[model samples]
Target chain A: DAGVTQSPTHLIKTRGQQVTLRCSPKSGHDTVSWYQQALGQGPQFIFQYYEEEERQRGNFPDRFSGHQFPNYSSELNVNALLLGDSALYLCASSRGRFYEQYFGPGTRLTVT
Target chain B: AQTVTQSQPEMSVQEAETVTLSCTYDTSESDYYLFWYKQPPSRQMILVIRQEAYKQQNATENRFSVNFQKAAKSFSLKISDSQLGDAAMYFCAYRRAEIQGAQKLVFGQGTRLTINP
Candidate 1:
């Protein structure tokens, strides 16, 4: 089974533009979470979506938002992106409320 | 706030040898989970191994094992018979085990492993 899938392996956008990254959850997983990783740094939590609703969020600002679809897929949307928005966006999926999460290949976003 | 730290920014291992990556975490809660994720050049986050707080026995998966010290709040990963393919940036992560909602994983800066043949 496909563990997890993310679209647009790589993207380039200018400042102030909006971008949407997609994630398909692993088979049998219902919860989806998003994270941002900068070079030489660890992945930082952005937010999480479950049952089509946002359940928890990290310290990120309002510019970062996400949605979970009925199919268990999710989308991470960054609006009015800043140059600092350039990072590898990671998507992870888990079953129920388990602590272990399976991650995707991640989408690399480059803000110019 | 919960935080994970990987003191070693880089590590090297000779092929067929073993290497261990260090990790330390700060958390107020007693019950939690720690994980080792391998991110190769491909940039995919692959779960290497995991340890549950309540379990005293260190978690092991074949050639991958973890050294977990609950009292010291430390978790280390040991890779046996290392191969060139094992080279990657290894990240130590933490998550609250009791949370039923969206649990966020706090990750360490990561240690880049280089396997020399």
Candidate 2:
């Protein structure tokens, strides 16, 4: 089965520039979550999307937002990006009632 | 709020040997879940193993196993017969059992494991 897929694999944007990362949930999975992983650090939860609505969000500022599509694909949009926003964005997919999430390779965003 | 902590910043093991990574979490909720995820250089978060809060017995996955101590909120991962492919950044994570927003993994800073041949 196809696992969670994200794009583009890498990105470079300047400060104040807006960027949107896309994710396709794993086959047969319905829930998608986003995370940010800094170099040499574990990923931190950014937010989660279910049923096409954002269900839970982390401590990220309003600049971070996400959407889940009916087909279970998701997108993470970050506005007014800062240099600190540079990190690896990970997308994970999971099915209902079970919390074992499958993750994508992640999109590496570099803010200049 | 739930928080996971990994005290070890790095660890090393000889090929074919065993090593353990430590982790602790803080959560008031009785029912929850804990997990260990491995991210190799490829940067993909791979689930190594998981343990349900209510389960006393540790969970094992072939070469990977967890030692869960509920009273102390300690969940450690042990990797046996380590190979070069085992080298990666290991993260300990926790999640609320009743939470409904997918597997919102609260993660530790991570332990970088280096397997030496």
Candidate 3:
């Protein structure tokens, strides 16, 4: 079974540009969550999507948002990107609100 | 806020020997879950083992195991019969078993492991 899949293994964008990252959860999972991993640091939670609605969000600003489709796939959008937005964007999926999660390889975003 | 700490930045072990990575977390919640994830150079997060606060027996998966101390708030991972594939950045994570979307993982910085022949 496919665990989890993400698009655009690597990306480069300029400041003020909008970028969207996609994620497909594991076959049996129903919840999708997004995180940001900076250099030499652990991942920080961005937000979570369930039932086609945003359920929870982290410390991120309005510039960051996400959506969950009917098929359990999700997308993360970052607008007005700042130079500090350059980092590894990670997507994790679980069966429910809390359970064993499976993560994707992650998309490395470089904001110039 | 819950925080996980991995003091050892790096460690090395003989190919066939055993190694343990230490981890300590600070949380006010009594009931929570602890997990160990291995991230290789590919940057994929792989689950190694997990432990529940209510469970007394530590969780073990094949050659990977965890030492969970609820009172001390310590969760350590012990790798037996270390292999070359085991060389990766191991992370300690904490999650609340809640029903809300607030249930998210808090990860430690990470410990890079190296295996020598």
What DockQ does predicted model 3 obtain? 0.79
Question: Candidate 1's error at B49, in angstroms?
Answer: 0.6
How do the candidates rank by DockQ, highest first? 1, 3, 2
The digit string of per-residue lDDT tens for model 2 on B1-117 reads: 888999999999999999999999999999998999999989889989989999989999999999999999999999999999999999999988985445588999999999999
Between candidates 2 and 3, the one scoring higher on lDDT is: 3
Docking quality (DockQ) of candidate 1: 0.83
Residues A1-112, model 3: lDDT tens digits = 9989999999999999999999999999999999999987889999988888888889999999989999999999999999999999999999987778889999999999
Model 2, residue B87: displacement in angstroms? 0.6
Q: Considering only N, C-alpha and C atoms within 3 Å, which residue pairs clash in candidate 1?
A: none
Alpha carbon RMSD to native, model 2: 1.2
**Weakest lDDT window of 10 consecutive positions for candidate 2 chain A:** A92-101
Tens-digit lDDT string for candidate 1 (B40-115)? 9999999999888999999999999999999999999999999899999999999997756667899999999999
TM-score of 3: 0.97
Per-residue lDDT tens digits for candidate 2, residues A58-81, read: 889999988888998999999999
RMSD of each: 0.9, 1.2, 1.0
- lDDT for position A75 in model 1: 95
* Candidate 3 C-alpha error for residue A43, in Å: 1.0
